[model samples]
Target: MKKETFLAFVALFLLTLTSVVYALEETTKTVTIAEQKADITGDRELDTILLKGVPYQDETDYLKQIFLEVSASNGTAYTIPLESGAKASFQLVDMNDDGVKDLFSSVQTGGSGGIVLSYLHSLKDNVLVDLPVPDPVEIDSHFLNGYQAEIKIKQTGKTYRFLLKDRKSYYKKLGLYYKGKLNEPTELMVNSYHSLKPITLKDGKLGLKGVQRVAGIANADTIAYVESTWAYLNGKWKLDNVKVLEKDQ
Candidate 1:
């Protein structure tokens, strides 16, 4: 073989090797962000719970692939994949009142809306199953006349009105309103669960409370908050109550 051809072949091999190494570094990098010991299987023995994920390139705080790793005391291991986001964390609680501590996790999307993705899992009796989180409350919201906004909870047929006169100038500047009148019919922005956490119900059972934000025209536009309480009953999450409170502007 010619010397020039051999040198070209060597360069091509080096380039291919470099590409493969870079790909591996991007995909295979995993980090354990959180760890805890708890008796999740109801066996009275502590299990190792780990929250692991691969960080997005150049952003260590943002995970691209998040999951839960459990090393049960009964010689079993479980790996449960979860949605990717920033600031992934988990809590162990007996949410279902079944005497076994279930795993609940939340991940922040790091968006302007402050949206979060959450999950629930049961590791009881060495069986790994995902418990469903409560869905977002359906709402009908839009700009009202005279610099006001309205939100109606579809679940309970409750309506709420907000006096957004304080933001009239801001709204006018954004072409949303003109002289205290809406320029066009515009629906308010409703965001998913900004926060969901375990709360003790009045009956001493554990339940979940979620807070969702309602915005007008934009995310920062103040409107109101919709809080929903949920209870785990008969193997499903049941909505208990819905509350709509106006934002204190």
Candidate 2:
């Protein structure tokens, strides 16, 4: 479908409880609609724009399109333009309180190796901006061993805080490394977001636990996916489970 047509369909689909409108206008600056990306910046608004590119002729503004989540329902999907320098991508989530849905986007800064910056700009009208990485947790995806190291997060208020995670190297020792003298986990980080802890639940309570966890997307053909697990411990994330963590008891 044409960009304008798709934009209209999406806006109508998203207008669950609130009425929405779609507008695509041209800016004076030269824009790159070819490589646009969108993201949800923690807010619930739906915004889109083309990623900016290098310098160009004056007044050759990049094409700017404004999209609002016309309806707010779950599983609501939409296509947003990729900015000039942005890698085409989308982020879908339930941001509208009306049980509706919306989509955000992201752009790959470089090749597959470098970090691909993404955001959930629900905090405002799907506005595009640099994502802020938290400083507390450490992360690495070299060989994502969710079997022993899982990560999870929860929102405290305005900020999203790390929750719980599991030990890093227990896949070799046993199911968990609660009693073993393990080295401080080598932190794994991308965009500076650390998958330090993996949260687990064994009993009626939910806290930190060191256990191997693994889950892959179920698809006939294969597609990219995001999965991290962590366990909570001692007001922070330790590489082990809080349940059997020897020193704790």
Candidate 3:
């Protein structure tokens, strides 16, 4: 082949290879940006926020580090620093009963189940401050009513009630339940309870209604246990009231 012909063929081949390389680079792209309206600052006004993250892949699954960007209506923007390895979720709740909503979110701390680590951003003087949850009692099931937060925990069959005082969550255990025959609490025992179906207190008694395991076997099917109520007397939850609907024989 002539010199000019050979040069022309080389140029065309290089152009086609570059195009393929560009297409391949575009296909494996992973970073993404998303936006949502949330009341992060505890103000009634809905603020615009952006979530910027990149896909992180591993042998089992994929996760991301979602960085939250809060934008004010007055053209001011702030970034709530979110670290790596933990996923985030956001919710607006009036935790202090101050008419304005507080920001609620959680970051996963390696548990596939049970309660993950959570964060409460309570608005202090129009600024969001990180209010850490009280240690030792992991959040099992929570019920938010106006300014009161009734939270149950894993292992224990008692409910912890917290009242919002002075723009913060305060759980004042009065040590009121002195007369009650309660079961010895065990960890991961009440895992069968439904999370979406909230267990509530009515007429001063919080009932425990769920299927119990047969002879406490690991893989055996559960049997319907009789209904029982935990009474709230004085200021603490008590298992003094037991109304057995069906005995677990």
Candidate 4:
């Protein structure tokens, strides 16, 4: 993968983990912990990789693990290692409907850069083959914490926490908590870090999508955005029309 492509994924990932929330006074909304479902990957399918190891490594190691498949049916279960400092926890999933599981897992390096790479391995001719996620740009030497697929729900007037959308088009996990009865926020702020890019689902695979940054303001005519700065709306930023912006540059 080219370096810039990797860099975009890193940004999307950081946005998900950036921890975006402001003071309640300025931000009029509250998101109670609605539902927390723990899954290794964003896919709702069960995380079977945890069972591979007899004694699961320390909890932290789980964060930096990768997976390679070795099945008797697939001639010895070995392929190429795409990333470095390999520690892994992964389950098999058929991302391309090929009827066989291609190896897929989240991985990280222990070295100074410490970049995480998620990959796929397809069983072709009874062998495991590696395939990186398809992207328009090449990813190169970018720092990342992790990657995820997510869906964010916005109630008409309530605050809600964003969940991993079973259907993914965004690069990173997007979360939201909807609380209509609580205070309404003045604006909707999307804090972007690495890996936090626009995403959508296509052909049952997670694909890059687009995003818009909107400020919380409103006039009878139209919602306004100052370059890449603000957004205006009817119910303000927290609750209003879902449109009126463009993707980040």
Overall lDDT per candidate, in order of appearance: 0.89, 0.32, 0.43, 0.32
All candidates in order of lDDT, best leading = 1, 3, 4, 2
TM per prediction = 0.90, 0.26, 0.40, 0.30
State the lDDT of candidate 2 residue by residue for 1-249, as single tens digits. 899999998887788424323321222234343332233443444334333343234423322332223222223444333444223344344323223323344444443333343343343343433322223323222223333223333222111122123333433354332434223443222332112221234532232222211121112111112233333333333332212111122
lDDT of 2 at 12: 76
Across residues 1-249, which tens digit of lDDT does each residue of candidate 4 receive? 899999999999887665454332443322211112222233334322221211123443332222242433312434343343334334355454444544555444443323334555565454445554422111111111122111132322322222222213322222221322212222333322111121223334422221222221212111122111111123121111222222222
RMSD of 3: 16.1
RMSD per candidate (Å) reads 2.8, 18.9, 16.1, 23.3
lDDT for 7 in candidate 1 is: 100
Better of 2 and 3 by lDDT: 3
Give the alpha carbon lDDT tens digit for every residue of 137-227 in model 1: 9999888999888888988998888887788788888898887887889999999998999999888889999999998877887578899
Q: Which stretches of candidate 4 lie over 4 Å from their true place?
A: 1-69, 74-82, 110-114, 135-249
**Backbone clash total, candidate 4:** 59
TM-score of 1: 0.90
Q: Over all chains combined, what TM-score does candidate 3 have?
A: 0.40
Instruction: Please identify model 1 stretches exceeding 4 Å from their true place.
Output: 1-19, 26-28
Cα lDDT tens digits for candidate 3, 1-249 = 999999999999999999999997775534435567855564456678665554554512334555566776555676665544345466666444455555555544343332244444565345766654323322343324333334343445555443333222221232211222112322222232111111345653232222221111122312223233333344333443322211234
In terms of lDDT, model 1 sits at 0.89
